[model samples]
Target: MHIIQFEGSSIIPISILTTIASSLVGWIQVKRYSELSASYILTAHEIGVIKEQASYVSSESDFSSFIRDAETAFSREHTQWIARRVANRKPK
Candidate 1:
């Protein structure tokens, strides 16, 4: 570990830098970026599946079913996102 002293040895530059870096990382986690990322990836995968199904559709019923499934997937993702936000808002 390397440390630089400043202000007549009253301040440690290395410790201050470390604290700032950790605070930034903590802020990112607190913002739920990881959960948001996972949600997007999963939603994209679900949409890709729906897209593949779309190509095989040959009738109105099949198209309707695909639309329903796609809507359900979107709603599920949205609900999860809302749940995450609500969870963050609750007293902890």
Candidate 2:
């Protein structure tokens, strides 16, 4: 709607172009930041859960198993976070 407001081939002022450019830049930055923030929150919660699970171990064998499982989980989470970070970068 706003773009179509400039229907005719008239000479549009520079201020409108600047305003549109600024708005688009702000929107893109905010979207990327919010996505990164959400992924961080999710990863933090997952790591917290792993820590709580580790706290419940009672025997040596169980503790060893817990450590192995937690290590794998932590690694998986880290990999996924990295993937998300890489995927979030836009070409434009």
Question: Residue 86 CA error for candidate 2 (Å)?
Answer: 4.0
> lDDT tens digits, residues 1-92, model 2?
23323556776677788899999999999997897798778778877888898778999998998889778878877897789768877987
- Residue 64 alpha-carbon offset, candidate 2, angstroms: 3.8
Clashing pairs in 1: none
Candidate 1 Cα misplacement greater than 4 A, ranges: 1-31, 90-92
Best by lDDT: 1
Clash statistics: count for each candidate: 0, 0
Q: Which candidate is the best by TM-score?
A: 2
What is candidate 1's lDDT per residue for 1-92, written digit by digit as tens? Answer: 67787667665668789999999989989777777888899999999999899898899998898899999999999899889888779685
Off by over 4 Å in 2: 1-8, 84-92
Q: What is the C-alpha lDDT of each candidate?
A: 0.87, 0.81
RMSD of 2: 4.9
